[model samples]
Target: MLTQTVFRSEDLPVADRFDAWCEIMGRVYAPMKMTSEFAADFRAHLRCIPLGEVTVYPTTFQQTTFRRTPRLIRQSDPEAYHLSVLLDGEGGTAWDGHEAAYRPLDLHIVSTSLPHETWSGRLPATIVGVEIPRAALPLPCGRADRAIGRQMSGREGVGALLTQFLTHVAADVGSYRPDDAPRLGTVLTDLVAALFAHNLAAEPLLPPEAHRRTLLLRIQRFIHHSLTEGDLTPSRVAAAMHLSRSYLHRLFQQEGITVAGYIRRLRLEAARRDLADPAQHCIPIHAIAARWGYPRAADFTRAFRATYGMPPIEYRRDGVRRQPC
Candidate 1:
């Protein structure tokens, strides 16, 4: 599991919880003034995951107002971009004379270098916040600043992918090893750079590696969504994504896999699960094969045998026999 630090207000004395939380906030972020009606007996939870220079915090807290004054910035500034993915509740942020309101699934950004204030409504909120160094992003300051204090959607395009990735990492930290943190952090940073570049219409400014990774993520998403279709081929995927067939092939090659092979692997994996599923036992093997893009039973059998060293029929029988009575 990825290493994580968790903080729960309930673990401390009722009167001390809020103050302790404020101390934590100062340690994790720049010092800020936090106020809430629930401060008397605040109930909140925080999980912090550090990925190298990037850190992810999934927090649940009561409605509170947070303000970072110019004095705080002068005292110390991380010079980082703070992104909040509002999983629940409504909130607003104001910075540098710009103000915007945000709802669930909306992406809100603020710079630690800029004095700002953010407040949630009467209800509690669940937020997945990410802190990325300003220098780590490839975009220029002027261009990237356009996104701060502006409302962005985390429901579509690269933003959606990023939101999903953050939530999955936060929720399934145990699925990852300790050494994976830095690599995971790198992926998070790359996605953030792509997201910011795309948001600012400055995709050309991204390094070749960042741009390629972004495109590869988009292609993979498209392929997974189109996996059930029989005509889901490299050419079709390229055309759908407005790229050439060769480029699509090259992208997959860079990942050390061929386009066709990747598609086949996904399909076979799907079929293998169905073949071993007790609920799907009555379904014909040919039908199951066709359902996952394989039209011919013989061809599916050959591919399945090559990949798993057994025919679909035998595999299903073995799975059934191994089941508890």
Candidate 2:
């Protein structure tokens, strides 16, 4: 699952938010020469979710400046690439002898190991992205480095799909389970590869297995989104993808699970979350089970007990008992 941490300027004394933000940002991302007004009124909010090898950071803040100087690069080389998806306001960055302006939905790549200068104007700003490790991407260093500090249109084709996925993950990653982490990580990496290959017009250079895995990932995503629908069966999934039932079944072979088993397990996992959530104390276990597609309370209880010892009601009771005063 994606571990989450949130920091708000309001949490600390007005005089301390600036320095706090500077320190936190340095640790969450690579070290940068930071320059910003440390006024008492400055406001900032950061939310981080580390999903396996990929780390997602969503930030909104007041005017700020950041520089990745050669000295900082030599001091601590992270060797990671950041894909920044600007959600609001404006920003600009200069690197590798190039400078680019960015707006909402604009995607840009920043190399942590390389020197660059970036800044947000006096206006507030919001941005999100995945911090990808060097080994996660298939492209060689020299080839991938060409995209450093460059801007790409993130509103169409694979770019559009990639941005949508990032947005979803940012909003709902908390619902993910630990077992889902590695699978989601693979999907993130594949999407990054597809987006880069498309941008470089190097689709042919991508590994054959990666191309196939990407297709399966896309199919699984569709299934996940439609799981709540009563018709989220194999036939519906295949029809939605314009694929034959056999072909769709074959796709899940790579994951070592049948399509039906995958869907059932996901639903069960979701039901377990509701059972353990103190916030859902008022909701009945049967209702929660029905909500996740287990319409029959007896069957739901039976399956819940089989997967996790004890019944749903006991699980919820235990959750209540664990709450701190």
Candidate 3:
């Protein structure tokens, strides 16, 4: 059965909360006994549940002790990717001769089958965990394992998007419908893949078709946001995104055009829409041209004629004349 449980440390005595948490862990790692020596000062806010084929758990705690002591060996194969996001915490993990320290908004991925040890000192911490089948992720199996116990910061771009998505989901877990599980699972997979791709310097590893479509969508969004700026040139766009001007041009070339040509077409499209609107009939042609980044009326007129075989004034006049009563 699908189930969701929310717990607050203050709702129960500290000892009771600790015991309950251990029980939850037991269920999560069924047939494997789990134990913890929670600090007397421990406190937490947590939610756990099984949604469809995925298990989502979120925890916020302070001054906690965590250890899988006398580590019980699994009698069967354990295959799952445990993705964790540290919302607020100071901690580190030791495994396979590697150690990683984590701070706020950092993500960590670890495998359940791994022999690992983690410790969070006196600092308070919050984390969101997503447990999914290894097959759910679209990447080489060993790729994520390499990043395990390492910190992935959420300070910019795609990282920021993933961080925000996790934060929103954690804050509103109750509002999500059971039917949305598959879609949510896919989103989680995509976000994880994107993060790994960024980490590995292997953006090309992303399915080429999907990567191109995603890039185009991002470009379109960037262009739309800067439409009001007169100097929204390819160079400026490239610079804003830390891409080289030549690289930006190459991207536009994929669509069979140069960057400048694309910009011109988009501006002209906007100008055409404005001219066809009856509410803007009284606006001067030059004003419309300037609004769409044309600084000189003569230049705008020449370009409009070259593209549409007519000047802006005539186009607007003809368009209005063709309107039905």
Candidate 4:
């Protein structure tokens, strides 16, 4: 039930696209002076999804320069952090006498309380930005400021998870209800807090709930990435994450499942998907099982049969029969 706003420059008169974009930017984010060579016929698109106190804007726009001057800051400042994950093109931001160049998959944060200038390269930049109010983030200003304008990798660790979560939420806006917005906002805020703490080496600053949630997310991501490896197990996962095996089990216990059960369930789910896909029909059953962490064919057959109540071959055959000609 969540609502979203879509903007396409082509919907307006060619001569007015740039001005309209500027107006939209002011309303969506903050007041800023934006200039672009393509202003005459600026081509751009934006989708805005509001999540309680936070908002997500996924946009693709032609090269543009944006400046937030002290005068503008004085006039109005929402005191929010505009965190942008650059998906395409090149760009950089200049703030507080510091400049950082960024490419795709780089996270850039700018504080609305401070004046800054942002510019894109010749190519149109596709960015998924999360605008989070300063009050929503639990970290102190000084701690958060240390990360602003600095290049943070959105390709790995908590940064990567946050980036993925934002992009997924933006892409799948219709999958959620209005009542889910606040909850989504809470999750987003926690991830941002966790990322900031991780970067600052100040995990203790986060509330206990935030810390536990972040660690669980990290563990889940690690398991998904390593699902194909043969050494993926409770002991290996615990060792790699530097946690005791018992603690790992206890963590999964909260979910009403064991660590081993979680791993097996994930593997089975992956295998089931592949088995039901007609395109993968030619892939041997044993080969498909091995690809999903079950190296031994017998072990995979036994597990898959117990979970799905049918042998892999029978499942695939049944799936194929149900497909339309």
Q: Rate the local accuracy (lDDT) of all candidates.
A: 0.86, 0.78, 0.69, 0.86
Q: Give a tens-digit lDDT track for model 3, residues 1-325.
A: 2256877768887457766665665556432343332343246777876655567778877544344333543554347777777777555665686656566776767676676666554456778877777777788888866656544677776777777777777777668887776677678778877887677663323345444534554564467557768999988888776778887887788879887887887788678878877778999989999999998999889989999999999999998998879
In candidate 1, position 143 carries an lDDT of 80
How do the residues 163-270 of candidate 1 rate in per-residue lDDT, one tens digit apiece? 999999999999999999999999999998888877877432434654575467557656766889999988899999999998889988987999999899879977
Report the Cα lDDT for candidate 4. Answer: 0.86
TM-score of every prediction relative to native: 0.62, 0.60, 0.54, 0.62
Provide the RMSD of all predictions against the true structure, rounded to 1 decimal. 16.6, 17.5, 19.6, 15.7
Give the alpha carbon lDDT tens digit for every residue of 9-124 in model 2: 99997678888888888888888878764344468998987777888888899878789899999999878888878898767777777666666897878888888877765468
Off-target runs (Cα >4 Å) in candidate 3 are: 1-3, 29-41, 49-51, 68-73, 202-325
User: What ranking emerges by lDDT with the best candidate at the front?
Assistant: 4, 1, 2, 3
Model 3 residue-pair collision total:
0
